[model samples]
Target chain A: MRNQHQNGTNHQVRHYQALSPAQINRFGLVELGSSGPLYRFCVRLFGILALLGIVGFMMRVASSGFSDRAAWGYYVATVVFIFVTFQAAPTVAFAIRAAKGHWRRPVSRIAELFAVVGVLNLILLLPVLFLIPPITGGRKTFWFELHWLLPFSAPGFFLFFGMLALVVCGLCLLYLSALPDFAAARDAKGGIYTGLARGWVGSQRQWKMLKSGLNLLGAFYLMTFVLVTTLFAWDVSETLVPGWKDAIYPAFHSITGLQGAIASTILALGIARKFGGLKNHLHMEQFWGLSKPLLATSLLWFYMGWSTFLTYWYGRTLAEQHVLQLLMFGPYFTVFVMSFLLKFLIPLLFLIWNRVRMSIMGPVLIALSILTGDIFEMVRLYVGPFTITEVGHEMTHVPAAHLPDFADILIIAGAISGAIFIYLVSSKIIPRISLWDMKEGMLLTRVQSFHRAEVLVIGKPE
Target chain B: MVDKSILGLFKDPDSTADAVDSLRKAGFGNHTFDILSGVPYPEGTFGEHGPGHKLFVFPLIGAICGFSVALLLTLGTQVSFPMVQGGKPLIAIPPMMVIMYEGTMLGAILFTVLGVLFESRLPRPGVGLYDTRITEGFIGLLVSCPEEKIGAAEQALRGAGAEDIKTESASGGGR
Candidate 1:
């Protein structure tokens, strides 16, 4: 004997009932937190700060009149700056992954904002193109600038614009690929974010359009970043060391850039998680997941740095050997020690400790350490030669100049900060997270009897 | 540290046989405590605790060798063929020192990596009492007890939320 209930007990509830109830969308899931007033405020603050900094830099440059530091300082800063072009791809990869990772849920929006701004800042790099004129202007500084290739007309303009086009193209594609996310942000609220998201709507047609375009653009950007960054590294950085040239320099720059990107994202996430009330949906599980990349890359960065040195030591070239010497004990020893401690030692120790890596403090500390080492890497490349003090001086060698003054650092700091400011503001209007992705995750989740007698979530493919 | 005896809470079936042994000795092996984690931490050599690790020294050796080599190649080589430039000596050692500095750091970090791999017992084909479920987030505890204590141990395991008690035995790597 079977018992049937009016509401279909132990069966489908109200089969073929009137379809009058408001349809609850299980698929459309977006993060609950809104940037609110803080989003707009931060954007405005960053723009104000950046403009102020640029103005200050102009004032300093006017007062100083090319009296910043020695030739070595200029050379090193230029080398590191140029090498950054190669790093762009890896940096983008890092930013994307960090933003997408689950642990980054708390402050993922801010990270996306941070990355977009970083991409835009590449435009500000237009001024760096100015460096070419002085070198290629047929003017000699201690030695006539090497014109191994172009002996007739100045090719500086051509080289600069050609590289600029490639970078701009790559950046444009990357930005376009992020459009769907921006659309999601735009629809989030009626204020700033919605304004940025402007035309993006969550429709099948729109998604298809975004996915196809993004896939095509992502591949182009990836390839372009690889090619252009390598070219930039070779032409700009390696030559600064006189005889110090390595096949790995291009790869090294790229990998370091990736490391930098990873670190930057981690730092941004840390800042967001704390300042923004993000701990609710963003759980501890997410933090560990994001950490795995940082750990893996830190090791890779470690490997890249080591292999370059190992090969140089073995090859024993006059130029290579001297370049190594200038870094080790000659003039850059203190900086070397600092880099070692920050880059390898501290990170290794922290990563090995499971407790530390799992903790909130780990990401912050490691990011700071990497930043310090990054600065040191630049100094070693350019500063060591100039800063070396001749100990047993019997007229055998000349003492190079000291490290770069506060003025040079200030310039870079200001420029980078300005770039960061732009990112902060843009994010207020942009949907930093991919709404389509969030909705997809929602669709794949279901409540089920996970075991014999317990309820748990079963993840299904969308 | 949590005692291996409480492994019941962590849920190991083989420990049941051991619990019987403990029961015969008039002991329930209540020294057992549960591991707070999402994966099982297996136990080995019932009477003897596994060896504790010391990785601190590995990086030290690496750092020493690294700095030492960095000094020799850059500074030492400069003495050998110091390229004299702009009225400088034949062995212009300072510029070469830059290479040494980067080299030293590189060497130390490489050694540190080698040291970490060595200390962690990593890349094991098959390692101590493990269940794939642990990776998917299950905290297993390995209990040690005498045979006679089996019933109480099983009850205790269930009371502490043992998903299931499994007989965990180590199989050699090749197996």
Candidate 2:
């Protein structure tokens, strides 16, 4: 292991030894750990909080007779938590693979690790299931009462199964992508690693198969993720409130999720660098690569969101106007502004500068802003729709007045804590970095002096 | 017949690649020697013909299966139940597209993984020629030679700057 030697006055300046593929494997042999007391305390704290949140959620369900408003806060939190935490994570890995981005090797596994949260998201959907009333009450959902297709018609059924399929696909992708790492682990410590790394020989045939498998699976997972997000936007949010139809809303939601995924990935990489003892692996180039997408998605969010707002504002359609009022100018007005400022304005202003985009702290801070904005955005999108009482397929009045109760706070807090808990636990099980991918990268990448500073040159075959 | 396999460790990719070319020119067949290194160098790096890999078939087959499954679910449900939703058509093309897309992708991904596993034969025992040091940085060239030619193979490897060489006579493993 290369240790940082403090030379002269600058403590932050640390030198890294150029490691060959074999040397990289030696580092990979050690288990992934941040190994900080503070990290453990925070994880345990979050775990306890998550437990409390789950208990509180169940208690709230028992007390409040399964009404939409009764569970509205929980619903909003669920959407935000899932999207911000892991639902969009697969996109990070997928996008990198699709682009053949060389810098992705260090952080792709970090993004893939978020897929485990899909399981947690599925369990969290239970509250959603209970809160949804039967479609017979004139509730306008995607489901229809056709006796022959009854099993497939329910919103709950589609959502549950869709999530399940997503989770299973994620697991398969994670397993296939990390087979070589498992083989490495097995060779180092032969117990369960033997089963996990089964038949991985790293032969020419195996390499080809592995590449094809990862590519196809990655492409598939990306599609499923987008579809599932669209499903959520259409069936759950848009259709729930009568006359709340916005074609771009679903696409907007997806872009927001991708933005959040990128942000969360940056945060994870920072943690891994600072505490997890992977300074050599995580570099400025990785941050530089991700910042571009983050900026692009953030800009798209503004464009799409403005387009939706403008269409309604100019059309003067009462139904669309009402939704706009409810989300933009009504009780959640402040939140909408905060969402725009944090997610769009702040990120755009700061990230526009090349220096800020390249720096480690710049993007991380911007990501934090985007995440905060996402929570507010979720509140504006879902809470308004849930509270609206539709009669005769028309809203009696937009239920704009909003106040979060104690159970509401508990459920939302719990969901967030639960997401954190799952991610923390998952970090221990899987290698935080994809050792195989990193090795391939180290093999291909060479450093050459450009101008005054050293530049890493990545080679691709002709 | 007893067969002797010699494993040579080289300090850098260039020397290891040179030794591979030298051995191949000396009439060692493609299957006679194998190169192992921590990094994945391209197949042609050592002047060897790349192995043919037909892995795309996996995803292609998966795509077909996924499309079929989507058709079954979307069209099947529509045909079976035939309920008029909000006066809309029973077979909604728009909504079904979403389901179809997901299914197609699911099929392609899962089958691609299956293809990889089938081709790679993963979870199988590690090869005896493999050395943990290969992953650290050393490039290893393992070659099986006849008893009479073992001396020539070692000299060729040594001339190519092999840092360390080990030979073992094992009874019945070829290719």
TM-score of each: 0.55, 0.88
Please tell me which predicted candidate would have the highest DockQ against the true structure: 2
Tell me the lDDT of model 1 at B164: 62
Docking class of 1: incorrect
In the range A274-295, model 2's lDDT, one tens digit per residue, is 8777777887778888999999
Displacement of residue B3 (Cα, Å) in model 2 is 10
TM-score of chain B of 2: 0.78
For model 1, the chain A TM-score is 0.71
TM-score of 2: 0.88
Q: What is the TM-score of chain B alone in each candidate?
A: 0.53, 0.78
Model 2 lDDT per residue over B117-157, tens place: 66666545545555555555677787787788788788878
Model 1 Cα lDDT, one tens digit per residue, A1-462: 111223313111111111100111111113323455766677667666666656655655676543332332543343354334222433444344334432232333343344344344445444433333233322211112223334321223333433443444444443444444443333333344334433432222233333333333343344444544554454434443455556786676666666665666566656655654443334444445556666776787678778888987898766566667676555677877787778667777787777867766786778778776867766765554433322221113323436554555555555555666755555434434433334333333332432332222324321
